[model samples]
Target chain A: GDSVTQTEGLVTLTEGLPVMLNCTYQSTYSPFLFWYVQHLNEAPKLLLKSFTDNKRPEHQGFHATLHKSSSSFHLQKSSAQLSDSALYYCALSGEGSNAKLTFGKGTKLSVKS
Target chain B: NAGVIQTPRHKVTGKGQEATLWCEPISGHSAVFWYRQTIVQGLEFLTYFRNQAPIDDSGMPKERFSAQMPNQSHSTLKIQSTQPQDSAVYLCASSRGHERLFFGHGTKLSVL
Candidate 1:
């Protein structure tokens, strides 16, 4: 069985501060990792996805590097904005059209001005 | 293009009653997924369908939960004898093969 773990349940920071959300996964087969963001009262949207070529994926000033060796795809931002406050989820899928996703508990990020 | 569409943005059911949630996947997508979101559990995968066939439903509850995909365009999740513990947001998602999933706004099910 595959699973995803997010270490932080809540993260609070002021605007302009750097932010990081830790994500790690375990799987028997090769994994495709994803980052999703959900704003208040809105559905989750794909933020970024891992590439087999090892290129870092980034969106909206947030970036993540997939480290197969460590089974980690940590989300990072050099500076946080108030709008960045939301729930972030890390998910993993194996190889197949019917492959199901295993999602983390999610990290609630709160950015203040 | 419209992403995934889920009917009944909100549903309130009494104990012992039945509830049905509908989902319309994005046109041209062959895979559909159902997930449950709760304050305590976060997001949990319930089931999945591919090419209008049930692929995996190991996450679904054995007795009261059931899902069906009779056509490529629509799927349904039915819960019988609903209980308070079943209250949660039911999210529907669709994707082309194994690509990034597009989620619907979700049906907020409140079992009273």
Candidate 2:
């Protein structure tokens, strides 16, 4: 079985501050990790993804590395923005053909001015 | 390009009623995925299809839930005798490979 855990129920930060949303996963097989962001009233969109090539996936000033040794792919941003307020999800997909993702409970991020 | 499209953005049904959700994947996508999102459970995978074939349905409830993808363009998920516990937002997503998934607005189901 595969599962993702993002313990932060809600993270509140001022604009321009650094942001980090912790993500850890457990899986029976090698897992592919992903980060999806959902803004208010919008569908969840992919923000970053991990590959077996050992490359750290990054997009929109946010970056995350897949640490197979640690089972973590925590999302980080150098500077949080007011527009970053949304729900962030950590997901895990197993290897091979059966690769549907298992998502975390979700972390609500609120960036204030 | 049109992302995943889910019909009936909202649905309200009485208890013990039947509900069906529809999803239209991207034009060239070979993979389609179904997920349920709720305030309590967040996002949970329901099922998926690859190249119009069933891949894995382990996430779906056996008795009351069923899904079908008879064609590449559309898929359906039906719930029989739906209960309050079945209330949630059903999202459809598609991808070409094991890459970034494109999601739809999702069908919000409310079982009273």
Candidate 3:
């Protein structure tokens, strides 16, 4: 079975500060990792996904690198925006197509001004 | 596209009552998935359908939960004799044979 571990509980930061939400995984097969973000009262949407070619996936001022040796894909942003306040989930899936994504417990990021 | 659409943004039901949640996946999508979100468990996979057939339901409750995708457009999750512990946000997602899942706003189920 595959599982993902993310930063526990809440992560509060002042606006413009660096953001890093730790995420690690254990998978039986080759892993395909993903990040999903859910704002208050909004559905969770895909933030970024790990590339097989090792390109760091970036979106909306956020990026994550898949470190296979470390089993980590920590989400990072050089400057956190107030709009980054939301719940962030780290998910894992098998290399097979349509494999179910196993999600972490999630980290609530609250960026204040 | 409207993405995934889940009906009855919120649902209230009494204990022992039945609840059915509706989901309309994005057109041309071959996969539809159901998940339950709670503060305690975060996001838990319930079941998934691929090409209108159930692929896996390992996370669904054995007794009260059932899901069906009768057609390509819509699927339903029915909970019989709902319990208070069943209260959570039920989300529906669809994918176009790819891993990127587009989720719906979800239906908040409150069982009392």
Which digits, one per residue and each the tens of the lDDT, describe model 1 over residues A9-101?
999999999999999999887888999999999999999999989999889999999998899999999999999999999999855655678
Candidate 1 residues lying further than 4 Å off, grouped into runs, are none
Writing each residue's lDDT as its tens digit, candidate 2 over B1-112 gives: 7778999999999999999999999999999999999877899999999999999898899999999999989999999999999999999999886777899999999999
DockQ of 3: 0.74
Writing each residue's lDDT as its tens digit, candidate 3 over A1-113 gives 77899867799999999999999999877788999999999999999999999999999999999999999999999999999999999999855765678899999999999
- How close is every model to the real structure, measured as TM-score? 0.97, 0.96, 0.98
Instruction: Show the lowest summed lDDT stretch of 10 residues, model 3 chain A.
Output: A93-102
- Fnat values, one per model, are 0.79, 0.84, 0.66
Please give the distance, in angstroms, between residue A90's alpha carbon in candidate 3 and its true position after superposition: 0.5
After superposing candidate 3 on the true structure, give the runs of residues whose Cα lies further than 4 Å from its correct spot. none
DockQ of each: 0.78, 0.83, 0.74
lDDT for B20 in candidate 1 is 100
Name the TM-score of candidate 3: 0.98
Model 2 over residues A24-94: C-alpha lDDT tens digits?
Answer: 99988888899999999999999998877998888999999899899999999999999999999999875
